[model samples]
Target: MAKRPQQSLHRPNDPAMLLLTSLASGPKHGYALLKDVEEFAGVTLSPGTLYGAITRLEELGLIEPLESVERRRPYRITTSGLTALREVTREMGRLAKISATRLRLSGEFA
Candidate 1:
């Protein structure tokens, strides 16, 4: 048997993906975001981790907070953030097609 060369692939684990993708649908507060992400991605980000990413995204103009009625604040993706998400998803889509093709050729997929 011959060993197949491994191809480097862009994974969807980038820290901002969760928040950005979630906000792509609509705005959400921290707790709502945490629940939504967990429900959708099955990953639980600690408060510190989530806040850290939130702060960085805000600094980069990728996300902004919405006016809130109470303590919890909601956030929406900025135009720049949507652009970034589109690019990332496009790349992921290309990789997915490539992976599917490779798997089919290798007889690993039906």
Candidate 2:
């Protein structure tokens, strides 16, 4: 039997994805997004990293800046971002199901 390549557990270069996902619920300022993402992912993001993610997501049409006269501009997820989030969530669900089945089988054998 051929061995399958090892899968990466970490999401590579996914800060933008994470930011978009967070924004899907509603609009949020930069600082708010950073705080929420840190709480959700358990990772402290530097300003550079957070800003870069926001810029990239904006460029990709995944998010857009909301109406604001303040320096702290809030952003909202676009329809495209919602669609992408839905697809990613579906994939995550599939992976979780597969892992659950494997773990249950292993526990039974043990």
Report every candidate's CA lDDT.
0.78, 0.72
lDDT of 2 by residue, 36-100 (tens): 88888776778998998788677767788987757878999888777767776666767767877
lDDT of 1: 0.78
Instruction: Give per-model TM-scores.
Output: 0.82, 0.78
Candidate 2 is scored at a TM of 0.78
- Return the top candidate by TM-score: 1
- Model 1: residues with Cα > 4 Å off, grouped in runs: 1-11, 105-110
Clashing pairs in 2: none
Q: For model 1, how does the per-residue alpha-carbon lDDT over 1-110 read when each residue is reduced to its tens digit?
A: 53211111124754567888889989999999899889889889899989988987887778999999598899999998887788778877777778879777535432
